[model samples]
Target: MYRTWRFATGCNDACAIDDYRDICPVFFFGGIHSKKGFFMGIVRKPSVTPPSSRSPVDATPSRTRPGSATFGDGPAVKIFRPDTDQAQVEVPRQSAAADSMITVSSMPSAQILPMHPMAGSLARYSLRAPANLPAANALGLRVFKSRNYVDIAPGEIVLVRETGTAGEYRAALVSELVALGPVLFYHPLSKTWTLERPHPLPEPGKVIDIDIDQLVRKVRKEHAQKHRVHTGNDDSFEYSAAQEGALVARGLKQFPPEQAAIIRSELQAVESIFADAGHAIGQNYKDADAVYESFFGVDHHAVAQRFADSVARGQALSSEYQGTWGDEKFVGVDADSNSAAWMYKRDFHGRFFINRKYMQRGVLSISLGHEMLHTNRIDRFQTIGPNAADYFYLDSRLGRLLNWDTLADYDVPERSVSDAIMRGGLTVEYLNAFTNDHDNFLFGVSDYLGIGDDLPLQTAVDLFNANPSLRAHLAVNNADSLVYAAKSMQTLHQSKTEYAWLDSLIDD
Candidate 1:
């Protein structure tokens, strides 16, 4: 009993092989004569570790919980104790076989963050359980059972990658290993997948609380604008179901009914989300806002209020909307603005919102630059309100919002016949101007709405093609340079911009 080491709990026996027990269990070693018969090695004399050789594991008391840095079927994590900053323990991976050689390392557990602290977005998406069990298994995590492939408990995290054949970039879900301590992940810089402690999502600290109040001020500035037309000049523009139908009828004819139905449902959903307030998502926004909200649970109204407030302030103050950046202006990185660390699950949450395959902020801003030129779009053709002070304010508003980052001090392109191609023709001026005219007409809806013969052309693809430099920033394999899927956000302004209206007016 003198050689036997007991825990602080007082069990007085060292651990034995074949002991499948919880933490704080006794562990001791001996040779030749031990009963329960673990470690049948070649009989050498006196190889047992003596009492003076008590390892740290033997000295420490048991502190096991599900969240304990070391657990099962995973790595032995070297954890930083919550109470102190000191590095405390390294629980080695246990083996059931007594003779099995155990390989131990000093790696810590991985940090599992579905909502990243830095990125103001949900980085990892939780897959719908059991329904996606096989998909989860395909990414290499042994999450499914043998008999029916039932999903394991505890939600699984997945990274989205594009996997379809060339030209058609579809999203594919891959398994991501997340843990409380350092775990394995594919590190982008080194070009190797290695064991790394994942970045834990931080709490929504003081920085964000301050930023939210600042943004609220910005939104208030937006609420004072005169250019918005949704509810104004309204007796003539009450919501019209017939007008909405005629607007998309021809475009609808091109798509299969099933596909068209989904678009219509999404559009109606947009109307539901935005129509009541003067902020109704007009044709310019289309199904983009709805799809964006569905994909990331983004509060469109909140973001829009910010953008609108900024636009209003820009229109009223200077000649255009300007970003809240630069000397005394730089708003800092988007991720650090309001971590709502509680909200983002991954590191690249904001990246997806600013740039994605669907209608993303980049494409919309580019299109806005062109659309702002038409008096109908900017002035709202109202009998009640007056025209804007100048086109400079409109261009600058968009530039501050999307451009100045790229097409420096650029002019908003002048409207012309060629402008018909901009945003697949989904300009609000056109929508509001012709709603009464086209209420009964079903023809030319595709060209009129600015969508291609292939329904509404994927805006991201168009922007992606324009900005070839975007291919490298995303951490996914690009399908011939167009982003099918990516993990990081490349600045939209970094790409070369081609203004359709500018070219048209120049040609004329």
Candidate 2:
């Protein structure tokens, strides 16, 4: 007998191939092991009416219980604790209910499987038993005798049909395990297939009965769907792209008019950064935010709120260097930079802390876009693949929540992967352009230096893409370049005619 309790606890144990008994229990059917040799047996035939508190072996309609459904060939299984003989079963009766049921079969004690000694020795190691066994058994929610398992977690969205609703399917959220069986709660959502919720769902309440088989089927179908790139259906791609564009637009609209306009003007520049990054991985983007959502979901409001909250909390911290990083401004590295240990402190509790000063500089959307793109994405890592050297390198950074390291011990493939991610090479280029823009006080002198805003950034990206040991000195610290510009301007100031021409250029 497979111990299904591990599924409920989310145990992470590995079994050696030789120990078949120690293999983790597969979460096939709900509650009881789908395999034979159950402590007590119940064979249930499909029934429409609600089950009542009745004996497992001889379950017949009891007139005392009004509106009780008869279990013709089916018998009720008693739910019992190992220390007790049996417990009172409470099978709620409903006039129109899609009552779920559990099925188990009797087996000799000698045939019952024993738990692994190590696992059994743990404290409070209760035997796998559902709290709502009586209801589950009556409702015909039992594991199928099969070699398959589908593990569903609480708070996950699932497709479920309500009891007595004539097979009307809607999205339901898995609440918890009652009697070691799944309990689903109905939500008001019409389309429940996605995990993304535009707004928060109300707390899990409103218990509902559902077909476990149908739930498993929905999970299996969606699991398959997640792996395949949606093709031959321009509708899905078009819808997703349009939805993402609207989400970004909405995010932009939330800002003040002047600030929003500044952000809007920078959208094309920001989109170019993402487009160039996507080109590295052969991904074509119709909309920058669409590609962004493909990595992060279409939940812009939540991420923005989270960013705001992080900034607020970070400001509350007692640190002198709370939001001051002059180096970051020089090199287009945002607070998401992983260049030095000091920069790590800018992130409080996995979120970047932005100083209000930065926002007032009209780079609020730019910073938001940078942080949002840096958000962890499992799909992105999967696309990088395990065999790829950059996979482990990228994993180390993302797992550490460092986003991207501008001066990370650079490598060819690592640079490729980094360039493809918004936080990587794209960050270097975009930040330089934004920081050195004529309107930005910080680093704006770069635009006046004759050397283009992106020249240093491009050189850094190219160096990292080719040489592993090369540090991003030029990109990370443009102090020398700034010095050159200052001295050159000072020299021009000494020449009357030259200074007049240079002063005219500044006015222009």
Candidate 3:
């Protein structure tokens, strides 16, 4: 089972392998330290286990320049040296055998190239992932709790490339490096990392050479392509200034001027929300403007426009069933009441559905504002919470089935009493309830903007303060109010509450 192989010149004498078995992707000079330690031969999926502290390789360090070995185009493999962290080593491409036994040998004197610290740092920042795959499948790397992460922090920059393509790249702004794998990045115009796209580390020697000009060119190209689509030949797709005025006029023709004005103000406020969030994050507005407009661009379903027109004409119920908003969008109204408004990206949907029955300015503003977030594709991200406990709660058996329907009833007196006595409070349950209803995630944000000033949220908060009996109802029924109140309590009392994580969720 042992075969002696001569490593190409420049390899350290330690790399002389007398036996090789199941060594793949990369090779390890030192064998396993103990039976409990895993072998490098096993190509791992993300989140399987943490990197072992015990030395799996020899304690002696080696150095090599950051370049491909003469044998093949593949990048050099890194070996772990016990004395130093991530000692650099290279292997001849053809010498990498996955089925041969590997026996460690003594080091022989050879030329040791000096490591480029800056170049190595940049290489670590580079990421690569499979291209043109679903978000879930694309990020197959262990991210929850692995140690494969780069040194880059959240809000830092990194160069990324997709697998199966060469020379194409994206300059990403990292939102987070979750656990240890699948890097999450923010869109230039996004308020939060709700639209986070995860990327895996590059396969050896595949680190991207950062080029500022190339990245700028790619962004500009995206802007141009989006602009072309927006102003393209399809006249029906137009959402021009004329269309905006006409859409407003139709609403005014149907409702009283005062009511219509309020609706108009709400729509404007929604735009302001989108604008402010992007600006606060230092978004590239020149490029982002096109991306934002394309959210309502010509490709929008004609039925969506017709539905809006019908609502404006006071023919909501009788309006030709808005057919479908197509595969990319989800459009619906709250069946129970206008009091309950929610919106988020889940499958997909377009065009906000207005409940014509409740035309009050305050009610309409909240509903419209909430749905508008969805329509504009600016909804909240899906995650249980920021803490380990919250993530565990979400990954639990109950979290998977949690929807608005599966949720505990807001007004259940007996359950409230039991929960209070046993659990102290319902903070965690209520905090995590926004999974199905993303609009509730930003309720505190909307409150800050005065979107639902006259709604039950404020009243619910007052009730929560005044009576213990009322707390349970407000906690579940006025769930959004609870978020707002959480923010208020933290701000006024400077308390470290469960909802402090909401600061990461809010747009500003």
Candidate 4:
């Protein structure tokens, strides 16, 4: 016979059932009897495989049977089983999907996560798989090189937290994949990253190129305009021209037209004098140029032309006075009134200046001739000082009314002039007597002589004595005090006489 048994829950519905084979206690889906007794079915207890040993196994029936015999009328054998073992198989665990669903509900979204608002914005696109999420969180919001995320795809968003102790935050979108790395979206207007993070970044954009030459030209144009505006006024030009004209007018007033003409003519004569001296040793066109530029503010070409004209006229005048009282190669007219006539020596030659107001052509030539004589004597005697005073005195006494007549004659025998002056009245007794008592006389007479102002008398004395050349002239008598006193007295008397004579002539 074959039999089956049913198991029921408390609700009275068949829940689970089993059948067994006869002459064995093993359970199966079907049952069979054995010959040992009136075989109805085999009874077996339900059991689960051990948890540690459970694995995939086939459910095919096995031939092995339990050793239980005498199965007749045993009131339907019921199997005994451990509920602990049974319970292990009865309970079903949740699936992985179910676990994930639960986790998503329980955990907060990154938006609601306890973080700074800026940090939230920075992490907006940074969500990732569970495995990567921890690392992204650790990075926080910060600036980073886009290339750092080599695995990141283009157009994907990332969280880049600066790796520094200062803790900055930023979020970025990968816009491009370059050799270096993914380029992030950075906004220049805000000077920050579009990535939802707060952090400082490198300056953006290339520096604009500029053309320096174009800029220079623009600046020059502006400068020229400014210059034009500054110099625009007619009043300024007129004022400057008038000032120069006034100075020239005042200079012209000092000389009558005829005298001015004569001066021009005389300047012309210097060219021939320079020519006669030769190009090697005389003044050149360059010297003429310098003089014209310095005095007249004229160009070199104009100066040369004016100088040539002046020279033509000057040569004629020079010839006329060559053997007369007026003859000299060079003369300078001092156009300024404050300065006096002077003579100076340079390495190559001597120069003479005649006060323009005090000298006409005649006076200029005569004065120049006198200065040239002094130069010649200086060159000859090689001696300088008051020893020559005797010669002057003798010449003055002898020449009296014939002074001009005898100048050239005296030059013939230079010694004759010397002898004449000594014989005329310079005695050794007079020299010695004066030397002994002349300090007060010298000082007093020097003041009256106007060698310099009385207030600077001592300075004048010091200056005269300081120069060995000048000192020798006044001290030649071996009686310095006497020589000084005599000179001072003679100078004072001569100045007075000249002044009186000039006054009378001017009055006449």
- TM-scores for candidates 1 onward, in order: 0.16, 0.18, 0.21, 0.17
| Best candidate (score: TM-score) | 3
Q: Which stretches of candidate 1 lie over 4 Å from their true place?
A: 1-120, 127-154, 159-161, 164-508
**What's model 2's lDDT at 123?**
14
Q: Per-residue lDDT tens digits of candidate 2, residues 467-502?
A: 321212111111111111112222222343346687
Residue 76 in model 1: shift from native, Å? 48
lDDT (Cα, tens digit) per residue for candidate 4, span 423-484:
22223222221112122223322433455323233344444433333332322221112212
lDDT of each: 0.22, 0.24, 0.25, 0.27
Better of 2 and 4 by TM-score: 2
Q: Which ten residues in a row have the lowest lDDT in candidate 3?
A: 383-392
Per-residue lDDT of model 3, residues 209-327, tens digit only: 66666699798669856763221222221122121112222213344556556555654443333223322223222332222122122222322222222112111111111121111
Candidate 2, superposed: residue stretches over 4 Å from native: 1-255, 260-272, 283-508
Q: Which number leads on lDDT?
A: 4
